[model samples]
Target: MPGSGANKTHAVVEGGSIFIQKLNSSLWAEANEKKILLGQLISMYSELLKTIFKNKRSKHVKDIIAALEVYKTHYSDGMKKAEELLQLAKLPMNDAKIELKAIMELRTVLLEMNKEEVRRKRRSRAQNPRGRPNLSG
Candidate 1:
């Protein structure tokens, strides 16, 4: 939960690399440079499974469990699509449109999240322009 309240902005950078920036901070990283191993993924998935089991009443618990199982079956396809995205990123923008539906969808999701973050920041500023309590009696 270290980044629980921090906003992350993801970007596709030069050389087909993916970068993530933490808003209002100097934290930044090239995400794609670090390959996530199966062990790490399995550990995270196991943690999620434990959490779901502990919170059986969580909304859509059954559906979430089922989706996690199904994701295992499509691991190869996911890997392939990720590779295709990396390849596509190396090409010129115009020539990169073909067979990039997944990447485009991902881009859409990121853009929407970024827009929401911007909207939330605007609302926060409007609510408290000084970024602190008025502290008036």
Candidate 2:
């Protein structure tokens, strides 16, 4: 429900012929520019991954799997980012695909990080669960 203040706000907006609308339009165009840049960054990282695992296959399979898991998570998160940017800018959905891709790639890295950490902790505990026996004792 629009209040009296709301009515007045509309009136102010309506009074502007071209300038206000253009300003509002440009705001989102700027946002899209940044969003695409972020996407490009993601693409670059994906390329890096390709290079790292380009040749060696079997040895790093577990690592690659972990990384792919992370990528999946990040990709999902990227979709969420895209949704959010759309909602925020009130712009069309087409422009945000790249940013969303970046976001997902980030998720992939995070997944790998989590899996690696879990394995590391388990190994650490197996090696030394109690610690050096409290020297004071």
Winning candidate number (TM-score): 1
lDDT of 1 by residue, 41-137 (tens): 4345646776858856465766666665666554545445556767978866555564476576888889999999999899879888988986663
Task: Provide the TM-score for each candidate, comma-separated.
Answer: 0.24, 0.24
Collision count for each candidate, in order: 0, 7
| Tens-digit per-residue lDDT, 1-137, candidate 2 | 66798898898887875333543564436554444434434545556666767787565764765565566555555545666767868744466985687677888889999999999899767776787554453
Q: What is the lDDT of candidate 2?
A: 0.62
Model 1 has an lDDT value of: 0.55
